[model samples]
Target: MRTFLDSFFILCLCFTTARSLECTRCTDYSGEGCSQTTSACPANTNTCVFTYSELRIANQVVPLTTKTCGNDNECNQISRMTLAEDTSFLRSSTCCNSDNCTSPTPILPVLDTTPNGFSCPACYLINSTSCQSTGTIACRGDETRCIRMSINGGATFSLAFQGCSSANICSMQQYFNGLNSQLNYGVACCDPSSQGSNTCTV
Candidate 1:
């Protein structure tokens, strides 16, 4: 009877050892010993274990992907309105054939100086066509002129201050400055009784 009990105990030990061999170790994915509380099994014998430092180094070696302007309005914000070669006009739905589409905005010359001091709208210009001026035009004596595309979709003309010496002879010059910088688009016509020549006020 003692011999039978000893054999039974040996059989139970063998079963426990077989189960431990199936899972091995939980650390370094060590392939030895029974880890009762872990869900992980021993890693493949041929593969190296990934350390925390190794994971961090591998992460540093790669870049993560990101998104920009994923939606429609955001998409429109970065879109460029090609002028001249593509000659696009920023038209609101009220001015467009499609009632749902907003018009493309115009591309203007960027200036080193912004039009401040006076209550002027923000100017839009690309890096290549930025203006190189530093002076401001007063309402009467000083005048500043710059060429712009036509508002009527024809010629790239000059939109400048006519020097308010007198109110009668205040017609601003519209020129063809060989740069092909003309305003050939449409905007609301400023009433003659309003300020400026109302030439290219888009």
Candidate 2:
């Protein structure tokens, strides 16, 4: 007869097999030519995710792409924010369910340059958690709300962004908050037209 410890070991192994998944993981800051490698997903992550993001500051544009394991709620979503006429941020994500299943590259949303008759204070900074507004910037497209986003994880990782953004971007507060437990994230939003509106402060 098998010992009790043998049966328990078998059960644990079966549970691990049922929960484990393998997925591709990599990040491309240049947004191109990112080679992929496979890795096992965490027990809590169920889907393989591909994400693309573009950040425009003045005349400079930075693009990033990433593939990793995530949850189902992060799939097939796009988020956008316009801090000024010449500065903005956009991100999109796609997902798959099976092991090593590569999902299609996410496409960025069309840019809208038309002025939306709104404006807000704007600033962007890295390696710091506080920034003073250099000046005001005209909002564009559906960007009607002034917003602020901050992330801090240590001396090497810190970001502060403030400007005008679409209301839909505010909906990502919960998602951003759930991103990492070791990091601090803060998001605030308000109407720029409101009296004494200052949502972008620090």
Candidate 3:
């Protein structure tokens, strides 16, 4: 009976395996062969997105690009927000939706380095009672809000980030909260009119 059931399941699986969409997927440095190849997209995902990011540390920045399949709503939004004053953030993204339709190395939006006259305390502290504000950073582009994020890794690890954020991120706040594997996150955003007084504090 067990052998017969296994065979039946295999037949069913084979019959239903080809229904999902196909998309090009890879993550590589810009100009270093980013578009690798195509693959079957996961269930319910219908759009492919090409994301370019500038990851900034204390004094260094690295550019990265990735192609992946996701929802249609994610395609329309392009935003830049600084986590802990440029610790790590998805600087920009462009998307397309079609059968096997990821473009060849989409261009990243130029970062608006011109400060728009916004400031927030910045810190990227790992495992501490509180993350003190290192200093204030000038916000650029649509980064008009101050953001504070706390991530609890597990029993022994905790991460904290606070800095300037884009208004689009405030509108789509739910997406960022779900990233932690441990499912522990706390995020708060405040507008420019508030003087960012309380939002920047740990």
Candidate 4:
């Protein structure tokens, strides 16, 4: 009986060790290398994921990249959509499942700053009753609507982003999940009568 119990314990330990996966976690956008220590994934975590996004707000454009644990569904899922002249667009996600199987950082393409004449109310403020902006920006391409995205995940931690949006983003039908949070997005498209009105106040 003692021998059998010891064998059972050893088997369980071996199983757990076999399931452990190590993945690199890091974030960078300025063409810098993202190097970090490997982390042991939780037992339930399935895959390691890397994502890159380019966001254009007002006159400023920025990039965001991250590495995190993701599900099997996100594996090899590459999604990219430009919001009217690429105002703010989600780039892609590359997911791998093997231990320490993370790929290299993605290289971002060059920026296209050409104005597409799509304009909307653009403000990214927090806990404020109104959006404050001196002027509206030109929408690039296929982005003909004003959009507002509100994220509420943590208690008292809410963010608001109101800007130009493409039809692809405004009529988005799916809600995607990210590290520790599920993004619930809502969009209000600019009516034809509201275009170039400085504010989609309708």
Candidate 5:
């Protein structure tokens, strides 16, 4: 009886160890490479992910990069949104499956400026959950859908943005939310001509 109990415990320990995965974790805001440290991923995560994002508002551009553990579903995903002629957001991610595997920095997708004959209400604001559209904006490239994305960065910081986006941005909302536990997001999508409040509901 004693031998059987010990064997059962050993088997459970080995199974846990086999299911564990390690990944690199880091963040950078200068577009330069980040200093990475190995971290054991949570039981629900399975891949090492590297992501890069660029936000352009007016004439200023901000770039951010991060490496962390994620799931395989988020691998090689890209999302883009254009709120106005001077404001846009782009993000891309790459993923790998080995412990401490080095992933190349994700490349932002090329900007498509050609008009696609669609228009939508546009707004952007920080530290606010609701925003009133300044005006409608013309949609370009593959931005045939309207999107409203609200990001809660912390107790005191929130962002509201409504604009035109590619369909992938709406489909990948879950993956985006999983990228950072410190942030919460609400993403909705609709056709450009849709009417009513629930029009944006995905």
Candidate 6:
């Protein structure tokens, strides 16, 4: 009885083996090679690695001077990339009101309607449509804050300022200049020349 059962099990195993088919590989539309889905392989059959750098601001100036990498240590004293070919990285000031003690807005206005003095700390709400990247504006005085709104009603932006001295349009113009320089780095599509006070846009 044991021998008969062993022989039966062997026959069943052979039958199942005969019914199974081998998997086939397609050529033109094969999902294995780079031609179909796995495109752009790395050189030397290895993966590619990328490194990105950013700027650090301190004391209203660039902080880091050099960068070095080791097994456990990494360099952080690098600035933003400059336009010069030789200078791969350049340092720039961070957004105002950082730990470095530089104030973002300097002027403070007494009243929203009347421009009394240099208004730096004061906040002004503006419409998203009229306050554009390429528009001209005149300042009422020195210590006031200026804000611009996004075209799509996305976000509100405060002016990047150093300090306000008088209640003149010059203070406002300088604020616009600094704001333009900073925004130009990120938004290339937005032209800063359109926002200048002295310059006229045609």
Using TM-score as the measure, the top candidate is 5
TM-score of each: 0.15, 0.71, 0.66, 0.51, 0.78, 0.14
lDDT of 4 by residue, 1-202 (tens): 2221121111001012334677767665553445576677656668776766555546764555666655566544433333333345545567778877866555555544455565665665544323565556566544556666554433434445566655544543232322323333334556443553534631
lDDT of 6: 0.20
TM-score of 5: 0.78
Write the candidate numbers in order of decreasing TM-score.
5, 2, 3, 4, 1, 6
User: Which of candidates 1 and 3 reaches a greater lDDT?
Assistant: 3
Task: Please report how far candidate 6 places residue 115 from its true position, in Å.
Answer: 12
CA deviation > 4 Å runs, candidate 1: 1-117, 127-174, 177-202
Model 2, position 189, has a per-residue lDDT of: 81
For residues 14-127, write the lDDT of model 2, one tens digit per residue. 012334788776666665835476777768778887888777778777777777777787789776787556667777889999999988889988877787777777887776
Q: Give the TM-score of candidate 6.
A: 0.14
lDDT of 3 by residue, 27-134 (tens): 654435466667766566666766666566567666566666666766656666675544545445667777778554545567666778778787766664247676
lDDT of 2: 0.67
Give the range where candidate 6 is weakest over 10 consecutive residues by summed lDDT: 7-16
Per-candidate local distance difference test: 0.19, 0.67, 0.58, 0.50, 0.70, 0.20
By lDDT, is 3 or 5 better? 5
Model 6: CA > 4 A from native: 1-124, 127-166, 169-171, 179-202
Query: Scored by Cα lDDT, where does model 4 land?
Result: 0.50
lDDT (Cα) of model 3: 0.58
Q: Indicate the residue-level lDDT of 149 in model 3.
A: 64
Candidate 6, residue 169: lDDT: 23
